[model samples]
Target: MLTIFLSALALAVQTTPVPPQTTQLPPAIPPVSTPAKPVVEADLRPYVALVTDLGTITVRIETRRAPITATNFLRYVDAKRMDGFQFYRSTKSWGPANQLVQAGNRGDARKNFPPIAHEPTTTTGLTNCKGALSMARLNPGDATSDFFLLLSDIKGFDADAPGGDGAGFAVFGEIVAGADVAEAIFNAPISPTAGEGVMVGQMLEPKVTIKTARRVPAPAEVPQGCVVKAG
Candidate 1:
């Protein structure tokens, strides 16, 4: 009877459930540092050149940034439409210091093309800085063959400002060289006859012209530099 009781107790103890052992894993090792992503630099060298007959003017076109405006300018250039076009306006509003020169005559029945949508500075990431080149427009989606070059920094004309109608002018290019030529173009004589037909309220001189324009190959890499001003 004692042996039977002892055997029964042992069997009961063996059948009881035992608590599972908790596991403590080893600390995880951190990964090593990796290289950072490379910065995407825009190539602006192919845009460097002289507009010729206007002095040694170096131009910088922003095709990657301002595709529409740049493409418009290039279209005219490729078609030889701007070869003999005139710089019809030179506003005294800027004076010599505020040198603002304009060219193009898409409004003319003889030289007109279909209007294009407004590509403001905000769209192109270009500003109306001194020597900046911007598309000319009346209302949104009305840009044609006209463009303007800033003689002085015109902050008021920026996109989303009072002048831009919340959509500032499109800036596709800049004068990288021959600022003196730009100055000369700025200082060219003017007639008082309200300039070109398109430039109402603003005066026009019809003094300068786009003797020629061409599309050189784009650069493989962007050149680190700033516009070289005249002495």
Candidate 2:
């Protein structure tokens, strides 16, 4: 009977199934991150205000591109040489679409500075577009204090422009504000028999005086290295 009992216990143990073991997984590694690029700031340009009897016309001078002309203009402003100058010429008769206003010492050699080196549009990459501030000269490198503000895009004044003088006018700055005042000056009265050559009948009878010209604060919102384009 003891042998029979031992045999039954052995049979029961052998018939029971063994439990299966679970396999363990390794931990996942995190991905590597890339570094971000740094932000760059814009380069701001200089601004000047021309307070006129009609209104104020603000301009942004391109010192980087037209250093010679722009510096010359700033010199005059700093010395107060343009304080009593006038916008004496209006080319409205050129056509309703073509217009510009001229301002400076008005041939007052006493108030004039020496002529500056010519900065052609080719070199400066500037154009005589609307609201452009360009130097007026009889020949290359003859520009003095006289300058003009365009009320229209005069591509003919661009260097090497087709059907235009090879040496175009030097554009050093652009009107940023008070273009309306410029337009008003352009539409002002003209003399019937004033001016010479093509300038005849294009002279303003009563010139618009530049009450003051000084460097004003630049707009904070304007980013640095920003290029001012014509509106």
Instruction: Identify the leading candidate in terms of lDDT.
Output: 2
lDDT of 1 by residue, 140-205 (tens): 688888888788887666775674468767777887656788777766766655645645535544
Clashing pairs in 2: 42-224, 43-224, 43-225, 44-224, 44-225
Question: Per-residue CA lDDT of candidate 2, range 118-186, in tens?
Answer: 988887878888888899999999898999898888888888789877888999988877888998898
**TM-score quality measure for candidate 2:** 0.80
Worst 10 residues of 2 by lDDT: 222-231
| Clashing pairs for predicted structure model 1, backbone only | 87-208, 99-151, 117-141, 159-168, 195-204
Off by over 4 Å in 1: 1-53, 96-98, 106-111, 162-164, 196-206, 217-231
Task: State how far residue 107 of model 1 sits from its true place (Å).
Answer: 9.4
Error of 1 at 102 (Å): 0.3
